[model samples]
Target chain A: MADHEHKDNEQLGAAGFNRRGLLKCMAWAGTGVLWTVNGGVPRSLGLLGEAAAAESHAGGLTFLQISDSHVGFDKPANPNALGTFQEAIAKIKAMPTQPAFIVHTGDITHLSKDKEFDDADQAMKALKQKVHVIPGEHDVADADNGKAYLDRYGKGTQGRGWYSFDAGGVHFIALINVFNFQPGFKSAGLAQLGDEQLEWMEKDVKGLSSSTPIVVLAHLPLWTVYENWGWGTEDAPRALGYLKRFGSVTVLNGHIHQIQQKIEGNVSFHTARSTAFPQPAPGSAPAPGPMKVPAEQLHSVLGVRTVNYIRGKSPLAIVDTPLSA
Target chain B: MLRTRAVLLGGAALSAMLCAAAPAVISGGGPALAAAKAASVKIDNFNFTPPTLVVEPGTTVTWTNADDSPHSVREMDGRFKSAALDTDDSFSQTFSAPGQYQYFCSIHPRMVGKIIVQPAGKTSSN
Candidate 1:
């Protein structure tokens, strides 16, 4: 064990969380960042360490998903999103399964502020689990110059910012679709993948076997959730088409900050509830965006999803449990 | 800032996105047309501040798109639909008939809201 780990363990100062290879203090070109890795995935080491220790049991395809933390949002709905994110961590610690990996669909922070990123990283570190992420519109909202959201999260990604990885017998594809903001709406300029990304995707999937189950992680909805509010992706058809050959597919997104699920053919698309706040369901309001729920109801709406994988199971069962549930 | 406006306006239409620079003012198609009782609704991120509105019949309820995106006052469970408006574009639809008109943005169904067109000659105290 290293000096820090050995000293912290002796003093009982450390939470004894799985720090493993989580914090890779790699020296980057610009500012130095302590990049952490979990299960061969780079992650923000926040509360994940301690949280990881608490529920490091419940083995076999155990993973957690939290979306739309919206850290910088200061509104009546959630006065301090950072606080709610803590509440989410508390839940993760309480879970029976020490998930092998953690996935944050997008919108980790509201304004993509460096502080916000740090805060999210700090909180997630407690989990002590592998964390994979996609970027939501909010994260890139106030980015500087061309240092857009993708630049920060788009490491080793496709031209349009799409990337895929292999994990525990499953192929996870992180797609960027929030960029394809349609015309005549609130979205500025455009928000969608260009031709380059699409072509890469075709090539990316060509190597995978049809039997491999693919999990698509993105910020926007791959299916048409709500067009008026730009909830759905504009060029998702091509992206979805690439996955047609796959046997089982699960697409997870977070921009909507609500739970909307649909099963088409062998694919299942699910929009996760935001750990920050809950938005009204589709067609429940005059527009599509963040909807504030009452304080008491926050826990009920915010929670986690437990996905289990069996060698020869007919289909993967995804159990979404809200805090209230 | 745009999101706050949408919530404050109570789902009011946007002038920039919906009507191309023309502010969407509710149509005053009522007996008190000259004295149109104006009310504003807001659409934030993708939610209606007031998912369902209760207004007296003939009340000109204007939906303002205070958010950066365009929204419409389409009738969800009724016979009314508006074109996709851009940010700042506004749309106004006066309630001439008395019924529960569920409206939403055809472009974004999750951006759903309702207008309770009350019967004429009656006033909504609240």
Candidate 2:
């Protein structure tokens, strides 16, 4: 299996494809490849043919990630943002085996209006699985400063809607870094986890063994992607220090509206695509905003991510499938 | 400073021409009448145009969002703040004190700007 994966990597290199180019090609193809991790390294197992079979045989845990469903957005880039969000939900409903749960990493609403939140809630009700969510800057733009989002999703969460949970022997931590603009706070134009949350997180994982797999979810990229565009977190490095001892750590975030992945030691960071619209690559455009594309090519840039984990395996298999695919 | 007045005058003339019933204050107006009594900043492409503006005290500064994304104008010291402004929305704040007030978009904080308020009859050093 290792040799086969090595050959595939060599072939991709020979084709002159960088990592981002390879991901864009995979996204354009819409066939969706499956990734398997051995030790701390990840390898693609070609397409979904063998990956699907391996998933059923292992039958460990599968979960879905959908993000940036700006419900009230009506720009030229995508006039029907809510329509596309519903389409993404319909796609999830059609899957042969429903994931254990769904995690929406924020931007659930465009302007945090009551109608927008209502519309989002009604659409998400169609799915059978429960959804865990963190707030994006767009979701907390209400006049009262996040009161609307908290009233709906903050029943048991602590401090601006951050919490942790465990499923299938893997620990999951949901964080909120989009609160730099809230009253009584000052930040350097980037998302922040804050010192209070960092303290909570340090205690949250204190008792866990080093062997336990850790998964982190947040609205903005925990790692800095583009400082000029405010696409990264300010205090994430301090939070990451608390999780350094974990054997396998996977961090999932969504704010840039595109897919980006990085690996450092035992940690793998991933940003999911938005269901609403796409943004230009870092430094690719004058600034980051809704990027207008040909109507026919829109679906190729927007999609959903599915992650499967097998106990005792150090790596989680992640697959990104576009809407049209 | 001359170019800024020209652009404002041009905009005022265009608006006056578009609206036949509008007041005739902009037509044949001199430079004094077109002075920075009221200034405007445009938010477009995630940038605050006229990143630095000099105006007399009591001048009302209005920010207009032209981008499809939502943005808010917030004073760094919490002196003033505007709610989220959607496309085509406008927010105005009157600067009554002669001081420099730095602000940024609360949503996209990298987009920063400054409004320099000068005392009456005094030219702005900036």
Candidate 3:
């Protein structure tokens, strides 16, 4: 560790939530982040330190994040997306410890087809853990405006399928930002959470104490990663305002189809890798889409994110393990 | 700052190496046109190549998804709308009236493009 990092860790003291320490080390690792929370403070560790992170959190609560499955997609970038999805499930089954649940951060299907949804659901059944899902553009990008997605997954969610739940002392919020594509330009603008969802979010977290750790799951990035590609949420600043009171907030997203992390004050933003294919990193290509790699090297860029939360610790340790790795 | 520089550099290469050229369209249709003239806009690299296009009335503009990501073409006014387009998918709209049509990608608001329908004799110079 560098001298400044050491000083930053030391400054954490009783809080033990070295935000800067973790942020400074947030280099884009092909592997995911491992998060650990101690004493209501969240701390992050890289993939190299997953074992240590797991060992310290002996009986911690863990969850998995699998995103951008694109189940029906069959293209040069990934001819057999379903096959890769099956591989992703196998990886989850092979985990040393089973996660409490799995949160799929949207793009469950390629064209929101019924069979695509069914195939994705069946593939996910290989895992024993419970699964929570939010819609990605591909999941709800149909003529019905997500009617199919809402019918299957919007059981307890609010308008368009935004919902929150409390599990093991952590508050989990699944938001739907893919609901508002312009009537004509279908996929041109940034994702929108709309006013109704934002108002509901404000009231949903109003009662929680400031120390409560919050995990926000959505399909689109709440922060501005790339405006030209609509890789961000337009009303995210308002939504984030509702979470500003909390000591630790972690936002997990999919859509960009790559692993990227950002830290700002109490909130940490993370976009996970796709389970089926990889997209060019922001500004790396002409536009964001499936990035084709050598056939054998495809799995190296696609993987699942595992997040572990240790009670009383503010930081959530995230470990992103690629399927091939 | 570094990332911005990189993106700018990439933008330079994108224009030079990629196909954002204007599509050719033969002009000769009357008010009661039988076969509409055809032009195309390629949706690649998160942009509508030839961000602005000029065509005569009775022209059909097709937007094709050349990139792997899905996209849709929507007009600002309630004139045309397309379903989400997957890779290699396409949508076409026939413009009959002579007017300026402004549109954007609903999923990517920053991607704005315009279509100008000139009178029979006029051509798009801008």
lDDT (CA) per prediction? 0.59, 0.77, 0.74
Tens-digit lDDT track of model 1 for A1-325: 1333323323322223343332222100011111121221222223323443233222346566788888866666677888888778777787665667888888888656678788888898888787788777666544131145666666776664568888778888887664444433334222466567778888888988888878888888787666545666767788889988887788888777655555567676777777777775555675455566667766666656555444343234344555554
To one decimal, what is the Cα RMSD in angstroms of model 2 from the true structure?
A: 8.9
In candidate 3 the C-alpha lDDT for residue A323 amounts to 75
**Positional deviation of A69 in candidate 2, in angstroms?**
1.0
Q: List candidate 3 stretches off by more than 4 Å.
A: A1-29, A37-50, A181-188, B1-34, B122-126
The candidates, ranked best first by lDDT, are: 2, 3, 1
- What residue pairs clash in candidate 2, if any at all? none
Q: Scoring each candidate complex against the real one, what DockQ results?
A: 0.06, 0.27, 0.26
Cα shift from native, residue A97, model 2 (Å): 0.9
- Which of candidates 1 and 2 reaches a greater lDDT? 2
The residue-level lDDT of candidate 1 at A310 comes to: 44
Q: Which model, 2 or 3, shows the larger lDDT?
A: 2
lDDT, candidate 3, B11-125, per-residue tens: 2332322232333232333445556687888898778877766666778888998877777776664366676788788988877765566677655556767676666544322
Q: List where candidate 1 sits over 4 angstroms from the true fold.
A: A1-59, A143-148, A185-191, B1-126
